[model samples]
Target: MNEDEILARIRDIFQDNFGIEPSKVTPEAHLYEDLDLDSIDAVDLAIKLQEMTGRRIKPEEFKTVRTVGDVIGAVESLLAA
Candidate 1:
């Protein structure tokens, strides 16, 4: 999928998982600060993303992902590779 499509999917997942409004989710929005996602939510988000994309996203990868766009970019890069 294209970047925009991937981002939209990611946003859907975030909304479903975290109860965050789609309109509030943005490329620069931080999961913790903006969405109020705790550590447990972070773990769940990673696992759900892995299941949805069939990609193995390590814990280390999440450490570098600070925003919704970062997660989308990481997933896209993994799919590309």
Candidate 2:
């Protein structure tokens, strides 16, 4: 899948799990700071991402993913690999 596809999937996951509106979930929006996602939410999101993408994203990678775009980029890189 492409970046936009990945972004849309992430948006859907965030909205479904956190009740976050898609309008508020911009590429630059930070997961923790902007979305107020707690640690448990982050863990859940990570699992969802792994399940959707079939890639095991490490916990350390989660620390680096600050924004929705960052997550898409990471997933794209893994998909490419």
Candidate 3:
């Protein structure tokens, strides 16, 4: 999927999983600082991402994700691969 599509999916995932509004989940929004996601939330997000992409989200692969855009980029890269 393209970046925009990936972002939309991310927004949906966050909203459905954590009740975050799409309007608040901007590209620059920090997962921890802005979205208030803790370590458990991050792990949940990884599971959701893996389900969405139909791929395994290794712990190492998820370590670099810190922002909404970063998640989108990661998903995009996975889709591309």
Clash counts per candidate, in order, are 0, 0, 0
Superposition-based RMSD of candidate 2 using all C-alpha atoms, in angstroms:
1.0
lDDT of each: 0.85, 0.88, 0.89
Clashing pairs in model 2, backbone N/Cα/C closer than 3 A: none
lDDT by residue for model 2 (1-81), tens: 987888888889989999999889889999999999998998999899889978898888778888898888888877887
What's the C-alpha lDDT at position 71 in model 3? 91
Clashing pairs in 1: none
The list of candidate 3 runs beyond 4 A from truth reads none
Better of 1 and 2 by TM-score: 2
| Weakest lDDT window of 10 consecutive positions for candidate 3 | 1-10
lDDT of 3 at 48: 91
* lDDT of candidate model 1 versus the reference: 0.85
What order do you get sorting by lDDT, best first?
3, 2, 1
- Strongest candidate by lDDT: 3
lDDT of 2: 0.88
Residue 33 of candidate 3: its Cα lDDT? 97
Write the candidate numbers in order of decreasing TM-score: 3, 2, 1
Best by TM-score: 3
